[model samples]
Target: MYGQGMSLRFGVLGLLAEEPLHGYEVKTRFEEMLGGTWKVNIGSVYQVLQRLERDGLVEATGDRGDRGRQAYRATVAGISGLTEWLEDPDSQPQLLREDFYVRLLLLGRQPNGHLARLLDRQRRVYLQRMRDLADQEKIARERGRPQVALLFKGGQLHTEAELKFLDAVVDEMGKE
Candidate 1:
């Protein structure tokens, strides 16, 4: 399941499209699929499953595990929703106002804000992330995982763009 403001509702639905799974199994499998890059909380998964069920996108199979946990599967509406979501390729505008942008905007509003220091710290963090992603990309390539490598490459490009945007901001701030 997706976090607040995250546009990954389709992700949970997509997994359900394959087969039915309980909340715990959904959490485990989602975390496994992403490796260590992301952590999907069990609570969030359950909440999303509940919401899906309420929306008629999924339904309880009435099949329970040995522990009495119920399993859920995608419905026809879920499949249709997933397909429609996947086919619509436009970026969600809400995502553009990420925390980093809010941080920068707030910092700019403060007359005595240590903008340079903040930018320097953020740059270091971004550089470290870029390094980590590069390492992952190399490992994925060595393991002959083209799909994984492609995902990493996309992340790398995004980080690179962020770095460039940061530099431009720093330059403009220097002139002020």
Candidate 2:
């Protein structure tokens, strides 16, 4: 399915709300928005679109696209739903099944030195991620995508926070 469930539904709805597009095109546009950070399968895109259409959030535009592909657009209700979702806060940081958390949990069962090495490696990776995000943010701003730039900035902050958490773990674990 989608990388982030529920969120992808709203993203698809928001894209359709902006303009009508075929399912494939919607997938392409959504990837473009995230600058290819997230990828949803074609089948998943159609599934989300189908669910949204069934939920009355979107409708067929009755317009055929290139090669007769069906196009979809957000309905009035879809626009309202999208707006509501935009204004609503996200529920996250539950830490359930998060990759890093799972890794840390499983790796903790291993021999002592494994976790220490992992923490050091992970810290370096996060630092590099921060640098990469700063570069990405600059390019996004230069491309007149302030929103995209903000997304990169958000990623940078998240990475930094994760690094801080790792540091705390290392401090308590004492390189053991």
Candidate 3:
């Protein structure tokens, strides 16, 4: 998963690479940076911070913030990892199994009307998500956040591709 949306660690590293941030700041900045596409819990952020600290990718700044929260900054190795990850082009699927593909296979056993309804519902959801992405993209552009806008654009493109695949599935199902 070395694509734009890699694991949360890289996101955390990228955030820290920009500047030091406390656990709470990391969580909030992550959500803000990605235009709210990924909502990470505060606990998860702290856990990642601890892991990053243990891995020597980050270190405590020895500065206490509000409520005694310790701030952390990315180390040189962390920045180097971030650079390497960005330069890597390996976007191969880590897992051979995809949940949606499995669900589609199961749905193949169902009647046409049932499968049609499910597909329709999914299409509607994708459409709504595209709309949301558009809105987020606009907000990001207005806020002068080009990276966030680009992220939203990627989401829009991916969702459009999914919709096309769904339509192709419906067409193939009709052939049977």
Candidate 4:
């Protein structure tokens, strides 16, 4: 099961690809990078770090921070893993299956279900998310973080796309 931990492991590796960091720095940076949409727990970060170290994906640099926490950097193996993950199109299914696809399946099972109504509500949520992302992007740009701003803009675009999809679904269900 490549479950929750796998996602976090990859996220950690991706962060390490930029620079070395301790567990706490990883957690804080991840939260900041995602604009707080994904909040990571320190304990889980430590657990993933230990597993990454054990797997030789990352190595302790024998460097200690002001707080005395050990810093870790991604190894060659970790960089290779990150590259493969980035290039894999198969990972899309794992992402969609857990959220949108599962919701779609379970929502369809109701005997008297109004799928159109479900879709409409989802569209509203996505629209709100898009607005939020836009605001975040503005802040990122003002802070001179072009990379983070680009990420937020991408999320806004994707949410806009989802709204279009929901509209199509609503229209199709109306024809049923």
Q: Candidate 4: misplaced stretches above 4 Å?
A: 1-7, 83-91, 98-100, 109-113
Order the candidates by lDDT, highest first: 2, 3, 4, 1
- lDDT per residue as tens, model 1, 55-152: 99999999999999999999999999888877765654454677888888888888885777778899998899899899998988898877777778
Model 4 lDDT on a 0 to 1 scale: 0.84
Provide the clashing-pair count of each candidate structure: 0, 0, 0, 0
Q: Return whichever of 2 and 4 wins on lDDT.
A: 2
Local accuracy of candidate 4 as per-residue lDDT tens digits, 1-176: 24344667898999998899999999998888777778898999999999999999999989999999999999999999888877765533444644775777777777676665677678778888988999999999999989889989989888887877777766776787
In candidate 4, which residue pairs clash?
none
Per-residue lDDT tens digits for candidate 2, residues 1-176, read 22345778998999998889999999999998997678889999999999999999999989997689999999999999888878866656455667877888788898768777888888999999999999999999999999999999999998988988997888877755
Tell me the TM-score of each prediction against the true structure: 0.85, 0.88, 0.86, 0.78
What is candidate 2's CA lDDT for residue 93? 42
Per-residue alpha-carbon lDDT of candidate 3 for residues 49-94, written as tens digits (9 for 90 to 100): 9988999999999999879989999999999988998788766853
In terms of lDDT, the poorest run of 10 residues in model 3 is 90-99
* RMSD value for candidate 1: 2.9
Give the C-alpha miss distance for residue 101 in model 1, angstroms: 2.2
- By the TM-score metric, which is better: model 1 or model 2? 2
